[model samples]
Target: MSSQCPDADNANATPATEQWTSISKHVVNSYLEANNALLAAMGFSSTAEDAPTTESAVDTTTPSPTAEIAFGDENWVMERSTDDYDTLGVGDYVRFSKPIADTDVSAFARVSGDTNRLHLESDFAEDTQFGGQIAHGTLVAGTISAALARLPGVTVYLSQDLEFTGPVRIGETVTAECEIVEELGGDRYRLHTTVIGGDDETVIDGEAVVIINELPGK
Candidate 1:
């Protein structure tokens, strides 16, 4: 539903016109509330406070480096390859494994000062929202990058966009995989990476735009 607020262009209308505009807005708001209830019954997750559509007028936000990684393609697959590892292309994947343990979590929290109970204490976390301990998202992201470094030719990671979908519990081994999605320029490749648990559940998914000095194993 569209906002029924008075148009800013017509702000100089007469007082009675303004009053009618206010009433129109009130009627529109009530109509929206009723429509939202109907939508909620159909499993819509958004509330009325969230505008159905909006365009930010101020364009001061920095663009995500990973945003263009998937821009022009529709058939892109991010899975690891059994295809020759030696002939890695702009969209090939490599995998590495790591264990999610308390030692790693604790060390991460200590170094980062992110003592959130869900990552620090098993008991506190159990009583809280998550119901159990979970690995730190940053740690998972960092570990993926760390694994990538082992392949060689990595000069710098220009940026990363990480999203944690599910929890990574202690002792669950996760394999970090990076799929070369596209080449941005010379020695700069956009990689779609993921960290999945032993059971094949995704723990952390991210895209990293990495700048490598040379091809790996070169």
Candidate 2:
């Protein structure tokens, strides 16, 4: 259940315990304040409050330590390609996957109050050429990142060249995969990507420039 008291304000200097009924519900900064005040009230008798902490506890770590993508080594960019040499070429693979669904889409519709038939009404899809409801194109593009995450050394994507070649029907599982097609100078690798449906037909096709960093800082 939500707290009965008014939401905390920036200007208010009230003690968090007095304003917020439960300690667990307090915001991070307010929780810290309440904790410190509670400790101060205890006269610092608790060893837990006085113990020294290690730097590693608060330090952030990379998502994948082993994943490495080779960016341009110095020579590739120096020699400006005048013809087909710019292509990323065959045998280069870019991987990607389906996006997980959640109740957020329902909440999003409720909050924004956008009751667009395509987004809210599955029945409306029956009348359309697509035959059934489909997610927004932008939403599908976000899933492309998840797919590329599976491949090694691909840290960041430069752009999404997404084309809705065919409708992505509801309940269908689609996967995005790519192949290296061209190379743009300065650590940018151009990948030709496609979103394939359960039937193995292309649903979306596009190109992306990915930055492959060599030797990411550990």
Candidate 3:
């Protein structure tokens, strides 16, 4: 879209539209330059796409050498990615599944100060439509982070946008799936994150922006 300059209020006033225009232009130009360079260094011919793309053509990811996240401890036994950050591209992802145990929900409520009766008091919830204690939405959303953390390199979360589709009850299992949807230049990547469970339904859906960086030495 072509942006028009807003009428200036004072000699020093800059137009809001113009500011946004310049910011957008700079971001695009910088991304194109950086992404192209990265691909060239990696010996790839394809460049970043306008929309999120799949990683089907590129099978760079592999299985984990060992399941560091053993079962029976946290009950987090599910998909784990063995892909390196340098090799990761669009559509790459890591998934982790963990049961929303009653204790987990209660702990989250206590620590996060979100002790809503709906999630803590079973009797209260039983009387309500839920019919039992439900887990906090944010607590379920945290699973997305847990999955993303399993990705290679040091994962630093830049932003996460989420939408809760359904509620999770104690003892129910939830799986967080995060896939790269866009290469946002440099070490930054945008992922399509979703948490689903209970009769194979989507409980929470969202997008996450993360920066995967190399360790101090390796």
Candidate 4:
């Protein structure tokens, strides 16, 4: 019976490992160069590392940090819209559209203290009726708040009713729109509140009563 020398085995393995490491680095560099060229050809002005974040890419006219967060994506027209309920007619409405990033759900969980396994864990969610992780019904409902912020006046939510009709996957852009369905008289109004899923389907629909207080000194 015989046994190989440990030092001899290590010596043989070193060159193979080093050779593969060198090859891997070359392949990576080639990929990076190719990617940069394609990005340049497609009008990508900055490399991914140098690209501006959604938060920084926006113009400086935003009114608040929250508004800046809501307007994270400029591709959506609603991101640039102003809050003005005075000009709203019965059929008119405003929408706030933004994609639900992975960070959003995690942040919601941390802030809300709603660490529902269905909303955070994939393995557990796969067994649920939802079949996979779906955004919290309440978190998705936050879109309603984003929309109402766009309305004129000091908007206050007196009450709201939500009927969750579908699940929204993270990263899917959802648009929350509020329409003046009926004027409740005085400074109050009845609104048709809804959230349109990224798939262009209605995932949430309900009604809300709000007080649109007039601006101060005006």
lDDT of each: 0.63, 0.51, 0.72, 0.69
Instruction: List the lowest-lDDT window of 10 residues for candidate 1.
Output: 69-78
Error of 3 at 191 (Å): 0.5
Q: Give me the candidate number with maximum lDDT.
A: 3
lDDT per residue for candidate 4 within 1-218, as digits (tens), equals: 01222232332233434534544564566556666655544445435565667986843442333322332335454642345556654766778887876666766665566656566556555766878778878888888987877676678999999999989987888999998888878878898999999889999999999888876666
lDDT tens readout by residue for model 2, 1-218: 11133324524333445423322333444445556655545434234644548765542433332223232123111111122323334456654444323232333333444334454345554565666556555555555666555444534876777788765554556677766677675767777777777678887788887875543442
How high is the lDDT of residue 16 in model 4? 36
- Give candidate 4's whole-model lDDT: 0.69
Residue pairs in candidate 4 whose N, alpha carbon or C atoms collide under 3 angstroms:
83-150, 84-152, 85-152
Top TM-score hit = 3
Higher-scoring candidate on lDDT, 2 or 4: 4
Off by over 4 Å in 3: 1-74
lDDT of 3 at 29: 60
lDDT accuracy of residue 218 in candidate 3? 70
**Poorest 10 consecutive residues by lDDT, candidate 3:** 1-10
The residue ranges of model 1 lying beyond 4 angstroms of the native Cα positions read: 1-87, 215-218
Off-target runs (Cα >4 Å) in candidate 4 are 1-86
Q: lDDT, candidate 2, residue 159?
A: 79
Model 3 earns a TM-score of: 0.65
